[model samples]
Target: MTAEKTDTLIVGGGQAGIAMSEHLTDMGIPHLVLERNRIAERWRSERWDSLVANGPAWHDRFPGLEFDDVAPETFPPKERMAQYFEDYAKMIKAPVRTNVEVKSVQRCAGRPGFIAKTSQGEIEAQRVVAATGPFQVPAFPNIVPEESSITQIHSSNYKNPDQLAEGAVLVVGGGASGSQIAEELMRAGRKVYLSIGEHYRPPRSYRDRDYVWWLGVLGKWDEIKTQAKKKHVAFAVSGYDGGKTIDFRNMGHQGVTVLGITQSYKDGVLSFANDLAENIKEGDIAYLDVLREADAYVERNGIDLPPEPEAWDIQPDPSCVTDPILELDLKEAQVGTIIWATGFKFDFSWLDVDAFDDKGMPFHKRGISAETGVYFLGLPELTNRASSFIYGSWYDAKYIATHIGVQRNYVAYQKEK
Candidate 1:
């Protein structure tokens, strides 16, 4: 079959892909955006029923688009966020082809281009931009109990309280997702057990302003570099209930059992690390580091911001912690659900080129891939710290589109059917 050709081909029709397509359109460069399922499929299905953005709606936007005169300061629900992308696609007439799942991508053997094998057919292009998104696949520990009859589900699959069994839940990892899901379970009157780890505790509101506002004013996200993005990005404090800095404090008062990180599991017995106190200290240290940076910024800029109220109100409480290092038998403990909020891992195995670095993730100098005529979008700190977020992706998309538009050597690859 004759492959349809375009100047640029963008894979995945989420925020990143949409941003890329919009910028390319502005440059008068014909392009196509291919999505595996529907546009923003992850937000539509992968997220929980009551999920909300960590930041305010005002900052979540692509180029040539901003949140309308509605709920700018408030957080948007998952469904509304998904609708915004779909609506934006229609507003800008983005060339998005839904349900075009890409099987593999390879460089043309004899030309300077790529051939993307999709569910429909192959599509050839002079330049290929991968907007495959930040969250690709869920990552879980290899030591989880496989023989046990207990229900095991990743946070991505979790919808609401009714989806799980009527018993205690063992939530692993204490990052943003883990914390949020654990709280949701608790609100539903389920016994919740949350693992403690080195979590960043930036306040959602500081000095009568939202953390997102301060972050933008101080350029907090921009300080992170590309190298650090590949290593381990620090977890943000959950922004579920507005922008509160939630720790393990007072959780016990609310019927929460806080434990140390999960170490190993066997025969329905889960062993936890004896480092809960140390983990709490680690989180505190990270929190203080961020405050120091914020203070320095205020001093440097001579901004007369008022003192942060109740910033240090959350203190380490010994009562909130149970046995830090205990082995709990799932059946005996009445725990029927194990939710792993351990984050995600990207899969770039189908790319038949040297697009990955030492970590098996796509490596590029900004969005330009190692292979010529190939690009990567929607990655954290691809160029700046904001590159991974909704607003930040637009900058990366613009940069990639501008560079590709000026490249005169992008020759289309084609063969006679």
Candidate 2:
């Protein structure tokens, strides 16, 4: 097979990969983006029809472009966002090799580069950026049974409410995805039961002011530094009110019962943890009270801070009822569909580097991995508020590109012999 060469190779041409490509182009770096499908294919294929971004329009832009003029200050629909990414790739002229599936990535033996084996051919690059985001793999809870008569599907596979069975639908997980799906199912006249878990919920509008307004005030958009501070901030602000949070409450208003955590599904019967929602909501509120106190302290101290704000103070309604675990005989209850909206996990089996920890994510400091030329973007708390989000990857990309440039210059001079 023919072997191509470049200064850098970026895997996964989604939001993070696109951002890295833009930064590399701006720096005049010769890099190649290898994607298994067309750009932003995940967003195009996975998200639902009524889906819109959780963040405001102003916060949705990538490196050079802004989403301000296209949609109003509100959240843009998923289709519009996908189109925006396509436009971004066109505007930057990002050299992306579509339909090239990367099979494996290994360090080039005794060379200052990496060798990527793909379905098409081999590529040699001095550096590789794993821009694949967290949603690479769907995370299903162990509580789900192996043998159940009811059909089970993850949120990724779920397209619309029509796909679910006619009887009662149990949405396992109270996160944004689970809650939104439950809402849609309830709206479609299905008897929906939502299995609530540890989740953060906030008002759609607080005191007639947009939630984004508070985000700006709290500096949720700022960059982060230091591991201790990063941990504190990540744990505190991990779940900002994505549009799904508010939709969950609306579903309750529409007569959807929020149940406890799902325990197991066996012999056609679904069991759940008793009083799970009460425990989870209590825990969530107690945690938020602490964060609120901390925020008050920060304001009282008059500290000038960065743009990213803490995520802890968002609260859920305390009056919501928690359904007891269903001990119903499978034949009697007639539950038909089970939608797992648990969450996502990272898969890095293709990366043949020692930089990854036991969790499969590369051990990195500000996007620079332990491996010499390998880097990462879109990791949680990488630079700040933007690290995990599509809008934040650009900042990380700019920094990583600058570092790569310096390293390339040093290597060129060393090879002058």
Q: Which regions in candidate 2 have their CA more than 4 angstroms from the true location?
A: 207-209, 221-250, 275-280, 283-323, 326-330, 414-417
**lDDT at 251 for candidate 1?**
69
Expressed as tens digits, the lDDT of each residue in 191-262 for candidate 1 is 988876666666666666677777787667776434442246347576587656766766656777888878
- What is the Å distance of residue 65 in model 1 from its true position? 2.5
lDDT of 2 by residue, 100-145 (tens): 9999999988867989999998999989999887678898886656
Q: Which ten residues in a row have the lowest lDDT in candidate 2?
A: 230-239
> After best superposition, candidate 2 residue 110: deviation in angstroms?
2.8
TM agreement with the true structure for every prediction: 0.92, 0.84
Separately for all candidates shown, the number of backbone clashes (residues 3 or more apart, or on different chains) is 0, 11
* Deviation of model 1 at 272, angstroms: 1.0
TM-score for candidate 1 = 0.92
